[model samples]
Target: MKKAKITAYVDAALFDEIDALAARRRVPKTQIIEAALASFLSPDSAEQSEAAIVRRLDRLTRSLERLERDQEITTEALALFVRFWLTTTPPLPDDTYLAAKAKGKERYGGFVETLARRLGKGTTLMKELPLDLPGSTDPR
Candidate 1:
């Protein structure tokens, strides 16, 4: 191909970078400059960039949707469990309340220890449940 020569001023750092890229790509610095100019002048360059940005936005939207779904599930589960617990638990009689409070504290500490142990061992009830259970659909 016939090529026309042109002269332009460039910063020393940018020149060095172009020189490095040319060396890495096994091409002349002029070729590198020409390719860069071609890309910069091409009308499709902006469209290609916009397409990339759109793809990124789509990924972000999907991620946000998954996050929102997980949050909803957590909120519903917590509300239902709290409601069930409030309904099922009986109020302690005044005379035995102090002793019962102490026992409850001890049980809570034991529960925390057990929970920590299970978490440390990576054991969870969700993991034990079969994926093929009846009427179960993956939220994902």
Candidate 2:
């Protein structure tokens, strides 16, 4: 195919980038410029670009939704635990308070160790529970 020559002015920085890209690809500067121009002038370029953006946005939306669901689960779990603890735990007498505190600290350490081991083993409560719980049909 025959090619025509044309001259146009561009920013020095832009020209430098083109030069670098052409050198890196081991292609002629004219080839790089021609490919760029072809891409820019293609009728479907905008549509293709928009479609790619929409795909990315869709993926991001799904990710955000998952994060939101996880947050809700975490909040619900915490709230339920707090409510249960408040209702079930009896206030300790003054004489036994210090002993209870010491025992609580020891229990907490054991809990941490158990949690670390569970996490290391990649075992999660979420994995144990069914996504569709019995007696619950609500979908969020």
> How much does each candidate deviate from the true structure in C-alpha RMSD?
3.4, 5.1
Candidate 1 at 134: error in angstroms?
A: 2.6
- Cα deviation at 98, candidate 2, in Å, is 1.2
TM-score of 1: 0.70
Task: Tell me how many clashing residue pairs each candidate has.
Answer: 0, 0
TM-score result, candidate 2: 0.68
Q: Candidate 1: RMSD over Cα atoms?
A: 3.4
Question: Candidate 1's error at 82, in angstroms?
Answer: 1.7
Q: Best TM-score goes to which candidate?
A: 1
TM-score of each: 0.70, 0.68
Q: Tell me the spans in candidate 2 whose CA falls farther than 4 Å from its real position.
A: 1-36, 135-140
Model 1: lDDT equals 0.87
